[model samples]
Target: MYSLLGVRKKQIAKMLFYENMTMGLIALVLGIAIGSLFSTLSTELLLNLMGIPMDIHFEIPMNAVINTSIVFSVIILYTSLQGFRLIYRFKLIELFRAEKQGEKAPKNSPILAILGLSMVILGYYFAYNFIDYVEKINFLMLALLILISTVGGTYILFHFFTVFLLRHMRNNKNSFYNGMNVISTSQLLYRIKGNATSLATISTLAAVTICSIGISVSLYSNIEDMTKGVYPYSYTHTVIDANKEAQVDATLEKHKSKHQISHDYLLKTLEVKGTAHENTIKINKTELNENTTITVISQSTFKDFAKEFNYNNVKLNKEETVALTSELSIKIKKQFGDLQESNNTKVTMSDGQNLYTYKIKEEFPYPTKNLFSDTFIVSDEQYEHLKTTSKEEITRIINVENESDSKSLTADLKTIIDNKEMPLYDYYTPYQQGIEGSGMMIFVGAFLGLVFLLAMDQSFILNNYPRQTKINLITQSYIKSELQIKK
Candidate 1:
């Protein structure tokens, strides 16, 4: 019609391009305004969730603004060019008949639909046995397979299976013509092919959102457990000097109100370098040959610790041993199928001139912190023999009433031990760090989830617009024809 009216092709293209660009500019302005307005509030919310004690000031970076402007400007320009191309490529006849000749129903095969279902099932099977696969060298390949199967299957299901199902329903005259089923079935059949990509995309985004939020919440909820696994004692450190040890005790006594001591015990252990192995294969290190430091604790001291901390008591024979390992190391080992129930494991320790080997009967979960890598519990007789030849270290372990809340006490103790040989390990550091890390994850997950949800909603609206318009036009045409036939 425009061409018949002597309107140039370039002129029509310019008009369409300007209209789209105007809308794009308006949306860009609104998006930037809303983002800037909520930036400070979002930051504050994130900080509070992470339990960080701090203040935040609001400010926008010029670089961010410039980058956003440049990116959006390019998008607007590219989309505007598409509008120009549409004007040039579109025929007036096709535009007029668009409502009459709606989207044709797409063809699909049963074999492809079945294949899609199988792939999805295969993906789920892999995910169900993920832990077992993690122990294998081909874990990365398994992960990639999972991604491909699930993502590809979902697209295929939406594109082919959905169309086939809708067409099958339409073939049933009784069902297709029942109530509003005629309109619903017809619309789905015609629109499924065109909207398949958007539907699949929405599903993938929803899964990502759910997974991110779930994992983040799980990590945040287990903060206390995680902290305990790494730093069991409220405060544990090697205090060599009697004067400094007395000063630490005095400080703890002075702050009794804030840091009530639940239990305070001194641990005397012999430190030695040794090789630990499971059967014939070396298991301690990745290199498997490096000497690792071992902390040797007597059975009597371990029993006392168990009684004080409510841990399960164990009795070890003279040659039998109980090994204590950190939670993270245990997890990594378990993933590699290294940590297992065995009666053949052994630990060989050496003091300058003598070497002592003990067979491991069990492995116990213990927080070694930074003072040592591994601790071994042996009989009183064996401990005495090892102590005679090895250097001994004294460590003071203190447990408070409220460990996480003792930040002030931790700071005070740090000052007292500063510039000294005593190495301090406190629960407060891990507790604070856990909150910060988990809280950051939760914030990021929630933010991305919200963004994906909004994008999904917009996709639905955009994908449905043309279909709905065509459906309404076709319905109007049918009513007019029916009235004409009746007259």
Candidate 2:
């Protein structure tokens, strides 16, 4: 083989098997082509089958499918290359031959293994990106054929590839059998044994790569929803003080007039019924620390508040009320313990003259973000009546109607709050704070991604590399005729 190439036997074998330069170059190009095909077919096929809607002339699922495919392709390429670097420490030639061929390495299996790994990775890229379209993909049998061929191709490429390369390596010299062909055949047998680990490594890495990337993209996208749309865009400011809504509206109105920011929708709710109470200070109402309980939100105002989030718009009569979410109720129950069950130590704040109280009702899901400190919900009339009867703090919210005018309106509202002497409430500037808050989510995502990438990469290097080397050493035995048979 070397005489024809004018190269030594070892060098020719090494180049053919370890380098597999011709095959590898072709396989890489083929991988790229396959990825493109997956992308194009996934998108265009969907469009052809399901006509686009006239009113909306934008890319829908079609775009997501194609873009996701392309993205995953890039990720797969990157991860495969990384894996290759990790696997090379074992030397590619030995891995394939000792593994799959089950003989000494032709010094060829390493490159052949790389080709195999790359093809399998390409298969995965296609599979992951086209998962939704897999059902629609008519080439299921063809792809299966290709995958099987690729696996067969892996073994054949290492074992007997020299058959095709004989002319290149031997110059059509039939005179030079000299056990060289035998060596190559033996190389093939050994490679069959080691195929599992190499393919498994590639397969495992591909799966991890897909999982991590999906998690990263989905989570980051959700962070945008959480910080941007849900908070600032939906409800700019949340108030704890009930008396401040009117004052905030006045401020917003001033900002609108001054800064051309013209939209502040004001809403307010005060306590009407102090029904639910955690027994504070051993039931001593006269003592200042009588109750460190959550202030009861009135049921009447709760009626109006429910309307904001598209609640049933149900009218609250005398009997029914919103209860705490079951989860929260359980925690509250645990806190009260025996006092909660006995009912003797329990307190209901109701005076016949004004205040009318009832038994405690739980607030399910709290109707608020979990991150906040204190939370309660009730009706406007209930809140107003409570204000008249008790000395508890009120909660207010000045909703901004014009999402576009958020900044100027926030400025206007702040001015109004200052002018009216209403102390600061929880202020949420949709644009300003929303953009800045996104950093934390981004930071967390980056940190987690880095950690995962490092951990998986370490596993590849620490674990796979040695296995690769051992397999190659065994292949070396086959190639160098070091494997002695003692019958």
Candidate 3:
């Protein structure tokens, strides 16, 4: 309304208020009816196609509907009223000459462009390098640096760098003299300089929309596979004593009768006092801890497990051991050098009276989901010595015959263990964990993706609306004047 009839704030306000409110009301009614019908049809069709059971009912949430209607109505009324303030702020003379006023081209600054480029490079360096230590560093400062550099750099690129490059292009006589090239380049230079902020805003929104959607979709798609990597077992139960072990075995046997149990095994771990030293040319490191927990498995058992995963079978001498570490530890080791060259760590185990030194032969993927500590695969003799010397902990690993029975079997076994008054450390199945973790990732990713897309679309519209209107008005006025001259 203000664009059509300038210098009349009171009249514009009344007209916009009455006319916009009436139109908004009509739109609201039609929108609600059409929206509800489409929503119901889509929901019913999707649910039926997916073979999912749902109670389909035409239920209107009056509270939500009324609240939304009220909010939009208030927004329209407020916007119409607020729009009048823009007219009042403008001088009466400027309003009268608004159509005659033309936008001036902005001056380009080479120095500002250089500074912005430097800032962009510095910000990228910080983002790429310090990302690993983001937890240790001041996150807010880092974020501010990135934000400032991106916004400032984008503005400078649009305002000055673009013009500078185009001017260089214009200097080439062959390109500049081409039909419409000179005029188009000159107009683009002016447009870019004048609308630098808007261009930057649109570019940033586009980047954000792409990144958000891309990352969200990737995470949502790969959640299941990633979860499997972290948790490879169907279920694990820690048992301390023989009685509890027997109870668990009995429970497994009972389940086996119902064909719910496929296979199971026992894993033994021992806590020992040890000092480990890494002897290497790149880095010589020593770790002395009294309560280092080491997983003790026989060579035969390790070989059998290796065969299951197609890992190279490792044979450890009586005085040698192999270390199995988490994925994070493996990454750290790779950062130093080749695993074989960098993983020559000597572990000295003590039984308070005697000490045994074992050379680490190799490293392997962690046998279980215990991520907090390191695991060692030792020979049968070494395992016996460690078990007799120190306290030992045992865990029962169970696999279900059917994937669908995992949840129910885990629940039943947990109940049996609980009823026996056994001290249960933890009970989990991979199926349950995978579903929960993946479901959360999908939910969060989808929510954030939708929000970013909506925000990007809204920002694009809001930023371009006024510029488009101005351009249209200028073109219309120019055409009308040309027609009048021709007549």
Candidate 4:
């Protein structure tokens, strides 16, 4: 319209530049204000989730503001240049006809459709067997392969597969001739082609949102069980001497009102060099026979603790053994099936003088008093025989009521007992830490989900806006034609 008014192309370009700059300036200001507000709110929420107590004041960094302004300024300048090029590239008549031009319908091919389906199926296969890939291939390469296949397949499927399917369905004369079927199917085919990339992007975003939120929720829910698996007992520590044990008991009695002891037991262990036949017992693919410290526990104590912890029950005769491994070893074994599944294998341990052999009965994932070594359970008679040759170490395992809420009691006990004499393991610290960590993940996951959802909505709106404008223009044209005919 400005050009048709005898306005010079340069002047028209200048006008467009000014108009765009003004709008850009307004948007930049509003965006900065809104972003600053949200940043403060989100930061406070994250800190709170992590159990951090602090005041959050709304403050925008100068560097962030300057960087944002520079970026948007470049964007506005680029858009202004585009407007200038548009004015010089076409005449006034072409500019007027541009709005009426329709998008060319994309070609639909059966080959492309089949290819897209194949790619999507291949991606799904890789994703399902992700663990296998993690072992066989580089992690980044596997991730890249999945990303390209899934994202590209999605776009291709939306672009060609839907069109092919719809076009094929239209071949049936009965359905094709039905009222509004042709119009609906034809419109969908074209609209999908036009928005295929955006649709694919939205699908990807939705998947990420679901995965993040699902994992966060799962982690938060399982934190308690995970903590118990790691800690096992509410309180555990090595018994340095009888005098220190007496002091611990006295401290517990002093804090009886605050925390009541639920269960207390002593574990006596003897560390010895152990080896399994045919490399039957392994940690990290390394044979346990090579200078590994195997902590020996008696069968009677193992049975008592197993029953208390609701673990697998095992009854062993003389010379029978059960191996106890940590949580990480259990996970590794689950991924790569247990190397030593046979019950016929045997483990031999020496106490620097006498060597005793025991048949392998079962293996269980359990936390032992010895943190960094494998635990071996033997018959009481066998254990006594080995203990005579080696020094016996004792650990006190104490379970208290309201274990998670025993923060004060733990502190008081720590103060009463010198850690140099006996190391104290309290459940409150790890449990509290787990809550904080899980809470932070949940917050982060929820935040990301919201961001993805908003992006999807914006993409949908932007894609639909032009089609809506065309419809409105057609409607207006029809009304004007009707008025002219009535006249």
lDDT of 4 at 245: 75
lDDT of each: 0.80, 0.46, 0.63, 0.77
Task: Point out the worst 10-residue segment of candidate 3 by lDDT.
Answer: 280-289
Q: Which candidate is the best by lDDT?
A: 1
Residues 151-216, candidate 2: write the lDDT tens digits.
Answer: 555545434443334333443445345445544444434443455445454545454455655655
lDDT of 3 at 193: 60
Candidate 1, lDDT over the whole model = 0.80
TM per candidate comes to: 0.84, 0.36, 0.73, 0.78
Query: How good is model 4 by TM-score?
Result: 0.78
lDDT of 3: 0.63
lDDT rank, highest first? 1, 4, 3, 2
Find the 10 residues in a row with the least total lDDT in model 2: 49-58
- For residues 1-487, what per-residue lDDT tens digits would candidate 4 score against the true structure? 7767888999998888888888888999999999988989888888876656779888998999999999999998899788768788998888889767766677879999998988888887898899877768788998989988887888788778887888887777799867557665666766666677777777777876787778777877887777766676778788777776787898789878867888787777887667766435432323333366578888788888777667776777776787787675666666765546647667878756556677777667876742434688887877798788666888788888888778778887787553775777777788889878888888978977887778768877886788777666866786688789999
List, residue by residue over 341-410, the lDDT tens digit for candidate 1: 6576888776545566778887777644432368888778777877776778887888998887888888
lDDT of 3 at 214: 65
Candidate 4: segments with Cα more than 4 A from true spot: 35-41, 51-91, 125-148, 191-194, 241-259, 276-290, 303-313, 325-336, 339-345, 370-373, 401-438, 472-487
Q: Which ranges of candidate 2 are over 4 A from the true structure?
A: 1-189, 192-199, 223-292, 304-311, 315-320, 324-394, 401-487
